[model samples]
Target chain A: MTSALGAGLEPTLDALRARRSGIMCKHWETVEAGLCIGEVAGVDDVVMRADLAHYACRNNRLAQLGLEQDQFAAAVGAATSRYGRRRIGVFLGTSTSGILSSEIAYRQRDPHSGALPASHDYRHTHNSYSVAAFVREYFGLQGPAFVVSTACSSSAKVFGNAWRMIAGGWIDAALVGGVDSLCLTTLYGFRSLQLVSDQPCRPFDAERNGLSIGEAAAFVLLERGDAAAPGNVLLTGVGESSDAYHMSSPHPEGLGAVEAMRAALRMAGLQPEDIDYINLHGTATPSNDAAENRAVMSVFGAATPCSSTKGHTGHTLGAAGAVEAVISALALGNELAPAGVGSTRLDPQFGVHYLFDNRSQPLRHVLSNSFGFGGSNCSLVFSGAAP
Target chain B: MNGVRLYVDGIGLHAPGMAGWSQGCEVLGGRAAFVAEVPPLAAPQALPPTERRRVGLPVRLSMAIGLEAARQAQVDVATLATVFSSTGGDCDNCHHLLDTLASPDRTVSPTRFHNSVHNAPSGYWGIATGCRLPSTTLCAYDATFCAGLTEAVSQVSQTGEACLLLAYDTAYPEPLYALRPIPHAAGIALVLAPKQSERSLARLEIVPDAGLPGRMEDAALEQLRTRVPAARGLPLLQALARQQPAEVVLEYLDAFHLRIGVMPCI
Candidate 1:
């Protein structure tokens, strides 16, 4: 995983343990919005591999960077040797994709005829499928591949898709993840919606206003867990639902969120009390946090320890699901409930147990929540392999 | 690899000269001559007036086909899960946002900003139908239709429930069009079930193959099949129209094609 928190899992764990915030007030590209952003450092300097030059863009660069870290490529190579390349699939998630390339192309359009530059490559860069295509070509895998683009819930939902494909005997394994890069469209677009925070986002804090936009690339290899190791984390359950209420606003009572959580628990054959920690989707927006709190209370109540790591990495948009999933795994492995950075005080109105400080405890099962624009909601359950 | 079997309970289609499933079958079955004229699209009446006015071509196209298939299958739209696939989502809205962002003002409309998401149609579908069921949106460039079919069928096979697959694509406006030239707007919707039912139109066994993909016989239909990503399902639709047991290969990824064995039910 590569995120604003750090480049790899160890560094991300370190930052989470230390409760360090990666968000800073900086201007990205030409836009001077004067807002806080969780920009991944050195993304502009990333160069595409020679063979994959046609897939050059900020999004692919971030994906390549994430793929190179934590010996992920080597792990995939081993999986290839075991399962063969044709038995694995690539399923990724992204929102705006490399629309920045088109945004730039639009600026460089010919004034006379309004023609775009001949060098513009929409298929490789701007297309929503580009990241998956790049990853598939990078690994030379010849299996089913697609990109899910359901806003913030995209990557989380890919887990459900991969699980179904594997369960259905179509593919033996899946490279499931998400990659979203900083683009003027999101930065300015969120700004237009008045959802961009001027300071580091304080998720679940009493004074929280809105979200701090961030960029990240997170990937996880999912295979059948029949022959799993002792300490390996296993994906137990996945639930997906739609709000059917509004486009940008979540359902007031979080009815869909409740349904998704309950469905996930039902699939896992576990009850709400089985969840040890909850990774809240808290984007720091007033309505989002409040709605999620209602959903969490209705399902798990106020007993389970929960925190939104968005305070550490900021909301990575489409990548938030995979990013937080990795974080949840890290927390389970380390048995640490990382603090919700930037949130000094919990909202008094929130009935759920919102963790404001790091707590060390024996953790077994964790639930991560990710909801997005269009009222799409997804919840995932992860548990440590039985000892 | 063994093929996965699924039943097609209903079908919806909208393209140039082919407006609905019956019309599409007529053209594909060779009972009627294929005509190449722009088709009229009406706003989905299920949506309220405010939302109805806000939607663009992609939403209208998806809603038109989705509602048609659901109505034909006699299933509650509120309970059916959906898979929406498109090469580029709302290209016109994207162009508008790009133009606005590039201008001196650099201020985008909130409605346009929200609608720019690839899942806008899926979101609107939920609102219009009041379906809290999960809906996923995906893109695989030109192979989008096949990809969506794969996902929808997999869902039906695994969950033992009906799934709706909606594949559509609209042409980009100007400068962007120069890069990726999708000629006309087209959409196809299939309501797939795990088991045969009273409304089952056909049974399909889908498997990945390396064989050459089937093509439309008519010149105009062939052009549409190649130009528009969603229309690549033309050969499959043609087989369904023939109502005879047949095997049809559809374009998937560069590595392999999807070969489906179609057996008519009625």
Candidate 2:
């Protein structure tokens, strides 16, 4: 039963009378307009674009933030203000810290002595903690500022860190987010693993190829219930688990994945049936989809509606978890599920329910899952209800 | 509380000075710190130039530290868990990608993209060591010390399998290097055991400080050493690894301060 709003153009709020609550995805990106949407070969309109690495430095694992030193500070200005001065801390997650800068320096070196070029700036922004430092100085945040680079699960862990701080009475507010731009290093790295999808990724599709890499910078304002404004979503729970199975593959049984989901449910004091929707960490790769689907079914049975937004956004790597989390919060507040843009036919392999097209209704609880290459799994639960 | 168990059973480090745990540990007294010098690769000629070009400092560091610790802990690849952690991950690679894309001509290398995933080091560790047991990588901002330790403890307790914990961070590259990080320390702490061993080395505990609020990882490490006279750990967690017969205690402050209780191997 959903709520009725203005004659109920969409599902009415009353329709949710017996449903209790659901997770709504509000502001979500279905595809990139300016650039090619994903890794498809024949794009009708990608007015302007270039190959993944031709765009930047290559080979080296570490790379700098593509942002101008000061520009990064400016980009986070609004967020710094929102979190307040003393209470703000910067949490960043990355896979490579400053490999690109090193690559450029390596290329420009005095090849003979292996010395860096005169133009090289040794203070590479690609260092893991640079973003936190930039954000800290950007907003003059005096509190503890740091970065988390846990492979794919990097940013997802940021939510866990922030929630604990708020719950444990650390800072009154926190600036939690992630930023990563594409680099040849990442492209080539994934290609080396034979995991990069040559075409735009199809997350749960049986015919899915691989992952179409993408990049983004996103942040969310996390405040306590006492300090939060009306309609602000509550960061109710964060669950983290390690597979200790394979470095790049999830347990075939989804043991670690299930543990993480269970932990989040326990911490939130909620049951699987209590969740309204799930934002999957579906990378569109055959392995990831297979593993994640098994895990989702293991937990949600078949009733919980689910969708892998990665098809629409491409796997943003470090930024994927945070961006999806932001989208989840927006959905809860607006009570709308952004239709799955790329998913044509539901993957027959996965049995969970998916919202077709776009729909508006009452939403309360949302579970966002971020599973990285190392089996570092984090599930963050966001709630819209007052409690 | 007699015979507080503390032993440097296995240690792995990635610093400018050395890559082996025994070598780095002997030099630093089991301390994790910034490396001032990076020696030439031990097997420079063995690895193809492409392999050298493909690997980053962290991955190189992980290999050096991982193999050594594997030897020290008598780690069997078939039955082990590894924890990989860094305050920041391959940002240099990410930045390069961004700069390239932002440039008039956007082109990033395919090789670099693969290296950009946070799990690169762990993947390489598995590839290099042929260790298939489960593994994970984590980032806790500056709290890498506590977060890495907690995850390691949980793995050993939950799975009861041998686990290798590697935590390290390198200096930021340039343009960005002009920025600041107290010190670009390449530190790796390895904790191991088989399935919550009946024979515990030191019981690690997380105690929160209700009064202090959110402190950094170092503070938690410092408090644990302070609470227990012999429970001294350096680089924040060195104290836990060195826990003595005395009731060793360490405190960690994240969003909330956690007091870690370590039960030394008797």
Candidate 3:
């Protein structure tokens, strides 16, 4: 993992046994609250996914705790009101943004019009920088705004980059998160992979076949140590690894997974068993679950409590890490081992502990893993205390 | 050790100009446009019938080159990580969708939409390859060649096995050509691993180059030509098969030139 790794960097894992407090959390129900878009382009003549996103983005009806994407400035405003407006930077990750817009615009094309619709500007909407621009403009942020496009690791890498930027004195405060609306590209792409289950995926289950596609957008406000160091969840460590393996295949031995996990542990200065709870990248596919199982057993043994929440909202792709990042912070705050929604029974072949159901326990530090295609692996360790 | 390295494990590409890269870098001897023959407004990128065109060429090239590099590494892909870098994304369809939207009545192709995601090819690669290892896609423009190459080398150093680094770029369509301002197209790969003294071909030497950031790219090909004149017409693909590193350089907009040092580990 250090082939191109710079110096003075470390990365790790933690165990979440199970306990209780309330900071905030995001569940499917939260997406139910209608997000009224002032104006939209096409697909309006009839109803479409982008149209109902105001209230139809989530799978379950679990209420999420974060602010709406459109209210990005309000979230920043909320943060600034408490800490006093400081230089703000923006970082976000996404699989597909405004792609729904593109789809809608295309569907409304005029045969002889000789031009596509103007509602969703192809250049602005498809460039991947639109969301970055949206957040920067909304909050009047001038520090730095970058959109990370590293497939699923996009959001986790955001935290990593922001940490470096802040440590390097590039910004005093920043807002980091991700947002990706569901689109046909994702649904069909998963279908092509044959990785998409006919139904919602059952992660870590012996009978588990594939994953369910979902959409989400989330963010978090990060600030450097300042007045009183607001006892908020502290960003602890991040580990990134590249295995140069095949475009789609992972090393059967979990070579890069081990390195990423080890790096995360090194960054946190902790051992494998030190982790309290582990949010796995269990996409429910045969290869992924088995490979991850091997990695966990080799490191933390079979006693660690592990669970995958993919059952709740499906796989959010790039936004998976960001949504799960917020979930980890909330986990530390609430001290509850979220119910592993998909898995019915653990694969007996793997001895590592699998959270069959949700449990409440004392939590400290948790490890969140988000791996992407093209052999990019990223692991994040979050703690309640400052490292 | 702090310097950068680039290698070729395999190759996957579909351009109007050519097929497979072999040793000697001669495979790229006559560079031309793959977009010109694509007709006035061709359909989005096509794939083998079995695979279909569910993925655009931008992504297809990434996966092909990525898989080819892994095959070259002679390692099981189920375990290694991947780093995919590209200058442009599945833009052909993106533009197509835009043109459709520009119509008085926007009617988009669901097929076009599905093939357009940046990760579409990645998802297909994962499902088809069945490796299940984590994958990452990055964008750094022309400099992506360096950023991605260095990143993979870092991964190999960090992991001690190998890393697959795929860099690809596709030109815009006619409409986009009329819009954007650059002539761009390419697909390249490297498998970076720990240097084996006995198998090592060449050692990569990277300095800070504060005064000559872009010099690495400027001097790479020429330096290789000077050192191995016999490779002038040698196909990049054949060279890779014979275990050779094709020297190449790229100049960045910011003058932060990146030289892809292909040291051998045969």
Candidate 4:
């Protein structure tokens, strides 16, 4: 996993432990949107592999960087040896994808005929399936592959898609994750919607105004439960739902969010009290946090420890689900609940236990929530193997 | 990981010359001559006036077929999960946004920004039907139709429920068109259920195969099949229209294609 927090899992956990914020105020690209962004460092310097050069773009570069870290590629190699290349699938998520390539290509269009440059490759870069195609080609996998682009819930819902594929005997394993890069479209687009925060976002805080946009590439190798070893984290449940309410705004009462959580619990055959920690999808937007709080309060109440790691990573948009799922896995592996940085005071109306500081505990089960534009919502449950 | 078996309870199709499922069957069944004329797409009645005005061609094309299939299946639209697949979603809107962002004043409209998401049609589907069921939007370039079929059929097989698979693509305008030259707009929707029902049109057994995919006999129809990603399901639909047990392979990822065994129920 790579994000504004750091390049890999260890650095991410270290930053979470230290409560360090990776958001910085700077001008990104040519857009003059003066808002703090959680930009992944050194993305500009990333070069694509020779064979995969055609897939070169900020998004695929980020995905390649993520694949190189934590021996993730090597792990996938080991899985390939066991399951064979054709038995595994690639399911990824991205919002803007490499639209930056198109955005830049548009700037270089021929003034006379409005033709884009010859070097521009929309199929490999700007297409919604670009990242998945890159990853599939990188690993030389020949199984089913596609990209889920339902905004924020994209990556989280990939877990469900992978689960169904595996359950339905389509693939033995899946490389499921998300990669979203910094682009002018999101920067200017969110600003247009008045959902960009000038400072680091304070999720669930009374003064919370909006979200701090971020970019990240996070991946997870999902195999059957029987393949897990002792102490290994297992994806127990995944619930997906739609608001059926609005495009940008979440349901006021979080009706869809509640259904997602409940459905996940039902799938896991566990109750709400069984969950040890909650990774809130707190984008820091006033309405989003409020609606999620209502949903969480109704489901788990105020007893469970919960925090939005977005305070450290910023909302990574489509990648937020996988990023936070990684954080939840880290929490279960290390037996600690990370702090919700940036937010100074919890909102009075929010009745849930919003963690303000890091806490150490023997965590067993954790729930990570991710909701997105177009009223898409998904929740995942991860648990440590029984001792 | 062998394959899955499900029933196609209903089908909806919209493209040049083919207006809906009955019309599509007539052309595919050779009962009617294949015409290569663009058909007018009406705004989905499910959408309110405000949303109807805001949506572009992709949304209209997808919703038009989705509603048609759901209505044909006589299922509750509010609870049926949907899978929307498109190679390029809202291409016109994307071109407009790119044009606006490249201009001197880079003020993107909020509505356009929200609608630019690949799932805009899925989101609007939820609002249109007031269905809180889970809806997934995905893309696989030209392999989108097969990918969506795999996902939707897997969902039905796993949950023992009905799922709607909506595949559609629209042309990109101007300079963008020069890059991705999709000729016309087309969409196909299939309401799949785990078990055969009174409305079952065909039973499909889908497995991955390396065999060559079937193609349209008519040159114009075959051209549509190859040019538009969503129309890749043409051969399979043709088999269903023939009302005979047949095997039809559709293009999928890499070297593998989905070999579907179609057995008509009625």
Task: Name the 10 consecutive residues with the lowest summed lDDT in model 1 chain A.
Answer: A26-35
lDDT of 2 by residue, B148-256 (tens): 5555654554444556777666655543444323234455656566433444444443443334422225453334323221122233333434444333233233333
Residue-by-residue lDDT tens digits, candidate 3, A61-90: 011212332355565787666544334656
- Candidate 4 residues A1-387, lDDT tens each? 999987999999899889999988888888665768899999978989999999999999999999999999899999999998888999999998999999999999999988999999999999999999999999999889999999999999999999999998888999999999988888889989999888899999999988999999999999999868988999999999999999999999999999999999999999999998999999999999999999999999989889999989988999999999999999999988998999989999899999999999999899999999999999999999887
* DockQ of candidate 4 relative to the true structure: 0.88
Q: Determine the backbone clash count of candidate 3.
A: 103
What docking class should model 1 receive?
high
User: A1-387, model 1: which lDDT tens digit per residue?
Assistant: 999987999989999989999998877788866868898998878888999999999999999999999999988888888898888989999998999999999999999999988888999999999999999999989889999999999999999999999998888999999999999899888888988788999998999999999999999999898977988899998999999999999998999999989888888999999998999999999999999999999998889899999988888999999999999999889999887999998899999888878999979899999999999999999999999
* Model 2 chain A poorest 10 in a row by lDDT: A1-10
Q: What's the TM-score of chain A alone for every prediction?
A: 0.99, 0.78, 0.79, 0.99
- DockQ for candidate 3, C-alpha atoms: 0.12
The ten-residue window of minimal lDDT in model 1 chain B covers: B209-218
Off by over 4 Å in 4: none
Ranked candidates (DockQ, high to low): 4, 1, 2, 3
Task: Indicate the DockQ of the complex predicted as candidate 1.
Answer: 0.86
Best DockQ among the predictions, by candidate number? 4
After superposition, the stretches of candidate 3 with alpha carbons farther than 4 Å from their true spots are A1-75, A78-87, A110-114, A225-230, B1-87, B93-169, B174-183, B186-266
Off by over 4 Å in 1: none
> What lDDT does candidate 3 reach at residue A316?
66
lDDT of each: 0.92, 0.57, 0.55, 0.93
